[model samples]
Target: MSVYTQLTDDQFAAFCQSFGVSFARAIPITQGIKNSNWFIQTTDDTDGAPSYVFTLFEERPPADIEKMAVILNQLDGKLPVAAPLAVIESEAARTDNDKRYVIHYEDKAITLVPCLAGAHPEQTTQAMCHEIGAALALLHETLQALQPSEQYGVPLYPWSDVRDRESQFMPSDEAKLMRDIWHAYTQLPLATLPKGLCHLDMFADNTLWNLSLNNSQKGEARLTGLLDFTEVSAEHYVMDIAITINDFCTTWGDAEQGESVNFDRSKMAAFLQGYESKRPLGADEKRALPVMLAKAAVIFWLLRLNVIHYNRTEGRTGDNIMVKNPDLMKRLSAYHWSHVEKAQNTVFVLLNTHSNTDQNNQIVGVFSSITQAEQAREQLIRDQLTPDQLSNHSHFLIKEYTLDQLL
Candidate 1:
């Protein structure tokens, strides 16, 4: 919700006019960090006309923003994404003829999209996590058709910039943790990891959930919208999964100074189950998840620190902006790294074991916790057998094994 440039009513009206949209009013959306967004209300000329979200790209280049629009356009009908609208010259002008979706307003790329329904969940349920996981998998699968290039590929992190600053001010404990994690990260078989389009930031704030009419009775929430694809890029799909899990599965407890991070293994299991339902994670992906989680934590920590440092240097101390606490990420990184071995010990549900043939052993699911594995096994057994057949081969084995063991 950073408004770098302010627009008046007339300016907004003209901007809308250029796109052949009738604008009534624009209300500032004060939630995001990267772009300035406005919830625009329009006259109800059409009975079911959708509300619009106007965005001014603050940091990203116009060319990059254009590419993002193309990506969104590609995902328009397939996913529940707020794809950027095609700009119309006038009432008679055809939007199909024009490839340009963004317009230069005050030298910043500005575009409008139909605001998706539903609200961001404050506390995500296991079902919600499952929905998001499946959605992300679908997003990755859908975006595989695109060719990668420097402009449209993975965005480079300012690791050197952050490292230089960290050397000057980082505490000894935090420094050691970062070094250890970075060292381990470098040793990972990154070249062999599956690469695809990743939403890099699928935190709770960026996701929207809707409660159905029977939601109260069923106690379930449905994922309706996934917002903010500005950080979308081609990267390791597992890394993206780790990034998402770190946000959605981790819970925070209140403390005197800061909150304590606790990775909810059940939620993690549910998310992975949902993800695997769409696209099964490879053995390499499962093994690298802990390191990727730590890497994600470090990346965010560095990013937040850089943001704070730059803001202080630029003398924008009192500005209204969403500033994340780097210390939280710092603590989280240390925690994940320290518990890497434990976190990597996933539960494999062996549903059907062929006679002395290890390769023919049908594994039903991989879960983060033994409890989740047992539950899945129970459900599988229940589905397969009736009350009369329940006495025959209803037993399932839940084995705790590191990802490497499975490989």
Candidate 2:
């Protein structure tokens, strides 16, 4: 949505001609970070004719862009995705071959998607959260129809390149917190978790809503368009849920205001209930929710940092380029951890007997009996813990605790 690559009026007009449209104007959309987007207004002004969203993909290859287009087209009627419009196949355009949805422009991939109706909701309601949750679940289920591909939508998160540079860019405390949350995520039964294509970024701005201004239906908002599938990829269903909840359920506050992160319990309950109506979460997924929520916040915090780093080094600074506040995400990450620590189910504490610090202690599992805790500790050592950390049984200790004792 940001204007990284500025285009001239003549250039835009010619670009629109490929799609057999008389370009009236190309208004740069300054909202997103990954791509150059424009509101394409055609001169046709004909009845039933529609406007389009012209996108210049900053990173994705033409092939990947085409794949995204396929996904959008597949979900066109099923969901309110901004599906890419195929280019008119003139002899000149036919040279690209099979790349109808995406075209090459200065070695960059570009696409034309229908400008969907409805505006991005400024304040999300419980009903909006519920609809989005159901839509997301439906999206995951619908994408399962596609043949699973090893080389599908862009790679999964905590990308090694971004992760490796985190310590270099972020403060030691923030970096350590991010690392700790990620480590906790590694302890989960990820392989056994339900997997499907996920819109890894489902923030409020990414969704369009037909918000009722007047009292037509108790001022309810209905989700219309789901935008920006750049981060859509194969992911765990629970992780997707976590990502969506981190945005839809939480009330984001500006860091300058000194406001703490607030997650709406009622909204979260409504959202989850709506999702379960479509695809019920597994027992393991349910248990992993708290950690996954924290993990989701960590991912976005890292993502914002990466964006800021690239913008600084690459000289992508301007009003047109939107750089999200990484600090807000950082605060959200810390808040989710609080939720994780406060859970009543967090009964079994795994202590590193070799480590002297309180921070080394972790809540490993929730079990009624010491035998169950012992079994979990053994499994954790075998699977998650390093050999050096678990040289012998004396290195680890499991302590049962009540909620009050935890405080």
Candidate 3:
């Protein structure tokens, strides 16, 4: 969308010729926020398929972009990702002997990948959340197995940049809130949390879902693509989970100026359940979820503020295509911190019953309040358990856990 380096028809054709491809057309893709992208139609003489995506990196360095290619290449066939295509050098051409998959065009790293199928979901459903969670778990597990020598090298947060530019913008209430959240984030025990390769930004727009035409179950969608790994990095797994939940499991109220974000517990529960089905979360990760949620909000808020200030200071160019409101994350951070305890305090009630034939354990309910959970347990014991089972306190189990603990 952001055409930092505009290419003419002749230029594109020549570029394709170097890569053993015949170019048909190049249309700008306007949906993305970071790099400049083009939907390219090229004739693949071998297969006749002619869809591809061309990207011109705006901010990332050539080395980092090459690392991204390696990451994507490692993920090919394992996950639904569009990996960068290897460049084919002409036999007569003598250039840098580095076996890289990226091309330096207009002094920026450029890459071409197959255009993946499906579209980003406008509104993510519970089933979609579950599928995305499971897919993310698989991504983490697979990357861990690959054990790439070069770790994901993106910065976790741009705190220094934000701090440097804090005085450029006028101070406001939201600004004060952001400062407080940043201070709190600094105190978190991030080193002890589980670490993995994370898709730091798993927002709905970065994911594509394909729904079956004759689906037997209603509201089911399959994840067809996970795009835009420019923000991928090595970070806490729980922090990645928090970032995703903040986006996918939250609904926003329409506001012309500032949006109101509300977390959906049912959707979150389903997502965690799906995640645990693949890789179970640790106890430390469970206890750190609330703080991680606030941290994720803080990270995005600061990044948005930085983007706004950078564009203003440097003068908006075609490369500066994204400008998100900082107030939205400010409100979200405040909401999550203000209601942290309530969101974390959850309890599960399990009712155990045994017959002469077999033993059965059932999760009767989960409640936010211990009193409600205890009441449900008492009712279940009185109605479903026998006198002998009631005398011995072995049949009913009421366990208290934070929202993350349920994962």
**Residue 160 lDDT in candidate 1:** 63
lDDT winner between candidates 1 and 3: 1
What do the candidate models score in CA lDDT, each in turn? 0.76, 0.78, 0.72
The sequence of per-residue lDDT tens digits that candidate 2 reaches over residues 1-407 is 78899889898888888877789878888887889988888887565344998999988778888778878877889999888877888676477547587779888898887788788876677777778889999998888887673356677655656877876776788888888888889999999998877888899999988866762268567788999988778888899898898889888766675655778755775677678779887779877887898898888887888888888889887789898777777888898776566554446666656555666655445664332355455555656667786547666677756655535
Q: By summed lDDT, which 10 consecutive residues of candidate 1 come out lowest?
A: 348-357
The TM-score that candidate 2 achieves is 0.81
What TM-score, over all chains together, does every model reach?
A: 0.81, 0.81, 0.78
Q: Which is the winner by lDDT between candidate 1 and candidate 2?
A: 2
lDDT of 3 by residue, 196-221 (tens): 78888899888877756544147667
Candidate 3 C-alpha error for residue 277, in Å: 1.6
With candidate 1 superimposed using the best TM-score fit, by how many Å does residue 167's alpha carbon deviate from the native? 4.0
Encode model 1's per-residue lDDT on 158-249: one tens digit a residue: 67678767756777877878888888888899999998778888898887778655873485777778888787877899888988988898
- The candidate scoring highest on lDDT is 2
